[model samples]
Target: MGAVVLIATLDTKGPEVAYLRDRLASLGVDTFVIDSGILGEPVDITPDISHGELARRGGMTLDELQHAGTRGRAVEIMRTLVTDLVREKFALGEVVGGISVGGVGSVMGAAAIQVLPVGVPKIVVAPTASGHHEFAPYVGTKDVMVVHSIVDILGLNPISTTVFDNVAAAMLGMLRAGHPLGPPSADTRYVATTMLGNTTHAVEAMKARLAELGYETVVFHSNGVGGPAMEELAAAGQFVGVIDYTTNEITDPLTGGIHNGGPNRLRVVGELGLPQVVVPGCIDFSVFAAGQIPSALAGRPVYDHNPEYALVRTPEDEMRQIGRIFADRLNSATGPVRVVVPTRGLSIPSTPDGPFWNPAADAAFLEEVRANIRPDIPVETIDLHINDPELGRHVAELFSTILDSTRPKEALA
Candidate 1:
């Protein structure tokens, strides 16, 4: 079995790192340590990979990094170097898991582990994980686990010892049981799809229908992270096609909503030229946490999604803008694509007699999309609600048609 890699800045964290190394050794796990310190000499132990060698691999001497004019610049250079080193080690099958043991270590170690493929067990133990720090840098779009060390990682003590012990044990468990990273097998036909609480029933039905069509569905929630993570997997060739059923992430960037999936949300699968069915599901509103609603939207209809989130209805103008954005992105698709719309409602709250019902606003989006999208792509509109099982079945049939059209005749046989 390969060893678990431990990362830390040895200058300031030598004693703590040394303690963690011994703890893992007692658990029958081999350890490979990397020192990212740039200034002082390592105190308690020698690392398998030293900072000096790390600097050399990055095309500079340790002294050159130390004199890089600013601490941030030096850290950036070391971070990139460590990331490349870890990637190479994983590629060579030398890494079973990874652990990073301090605040700064968490940041640098996360960059390294993010370069590793999915399903690799990566952990970050830091006091910062307990507080109100933004975790995007630590987890990014990967599955890295973050453990909050109850006390600061200054030195060995009873509390710190217990934490390090558990970290080692957890790594061992994952290394023994976790699935290895790789793409799906040739015979496994998987389809990627997205959904939200508002459209759960529809997606469930869609999944069943896709299963009946001899394809398995990997459904992603349309939360801020889920959409991008699905796209990342799609780019890795993990799916045959996509049913983008909940696309409110597109309205998020313009409305400052909390569910924003960044600018690349709808671009990846299209760029890959995968057959896709795009729906404007949940596009009638922008989401915000309670008490965080902006004053500009004071007069708009607000639906209380829960105690934590409020959904504000999008107006006609914003819907038109979203429509154009969707059309422009879809126009760049190099493969089979279709646009499906539910004229009765885009979400539960936008149904007739619902709080967010506004046919004029919805119609504005349809007009803009039809006007701006390419003439070859077909746009289908139905009179059912977005969550209707029939709507999901219809989408499944549409995706099947496109997939059949794109497959080679030999594969179809």
Candidate 2:
């Protein structure tokens, strides 16, 4: 196996990158450097074909990106380019491991490496190592490791040099140990799907169809980590397509539901520009633990779906906010996006004569979408209930259509 491709904007990180390259060489490992600098002297390793090429492969190119200067451009360029490059390299068995270093740029660029097949020795040493990793969800259950370089990423000082050397050693050891590459040769196209208990039937149905169609289905519980994790894979170009079947987590987050998926929930797919089909699967209510329900909702109807999970019906006011957030996110997607709404009900309890049925709140959210999301984004509202087999199939077909449209024409050849 070859070296773990050490990726970084070599222009600004000349000293640090060179130090890492030398260390890896000394350790008897081959290293390939990718120059993502927009404007600078020629780099040692092949540069990304072009900045526009990076944007076309994912989003924003290095040259067209709005950054501060050469350093900033290199950072952005490397972040996006390295992710795509590493992804491709790992796919082709050209790399056994990957390492990256930077502050925000390093973290962003390295996130792609982290998403590589589990146990391929992924390590990222970042300058900004404090706080909740907004990118952790994408890393998922992968064995990706992070080392904090307490000092800022400037020239290679004693501190920064030590950090990089240690990180390089860790990655080298991991690769040498030779962890098992996951199950033999199953080209399972990963399909990222979202689910909550209320929307289990639809998600399962979608999963069944995807499996029948020869795809590996990864069902995210949508219990805070699920949605974000699924989105992370999408951003890393890990997902062949996505079925955003249940978006209630956004409402859960907005209404102080114990299961909030955070603000960057919809951002991953939008940034990665993937074919997406969204539904208000469980939008009618927010989930919470029985004890965490607010006093204001004391008299409001509360139902225990299970001992561990409880549901609180959303009020008209909160639904408006949910609508605003959803619309704002959907409007920003650059890919072929479609939002599907089930008019009959969004969840099990929201069905006709069901415990959580409330048309006013659902209507309010739908109205917001109609008014705010652009016409080009494609909004489809169905008359059937969310779990209805007909509605399920309709959604599945819609997602299939969008996915097919997004496929590269060359694949057909």
Q: Which ten residues in a row have the lowest lDDT in candidate 1?
A: 131-140
Clashes of 1: 0
Tens digits of per-residue lDDT for model 1 on 141-231?
8889899988888878899889988888888888778865688899889999999999999999999999999999999989888889889
Instruction: For candidate 1, list the clashing residue pairs, or say none.
Output: none
CA displacement after TM-score superposition, residue 352 of candidate 2 (Å): 2.1
Pull out the clashing pairs in model 2: none
What TM value does model 2 have? 0.59
Q: What is each predicted model's overall lDDT from 0 to 1?
A: 0.89, 0.72
Tell me the spans in candidate 2 whose CA falls farther than 4 Å from its real position. Answer: 1-188
- C-alpha RMSD by candidate, in order: 2.2, 9.5
257-371: candidate 2 lDDT, tens digit per residue: 7678888887668657777888878877778766778776776667788887788888788888888888888777778888888898888888768888889888998998888
Taking the candidates one at a time, how many backbone clashes does each contain?
0, 0
Task: Kindly give the stretch of ten consecutive residues in candidate 2 with the minimal lDDT sum.
Answer: 42-51
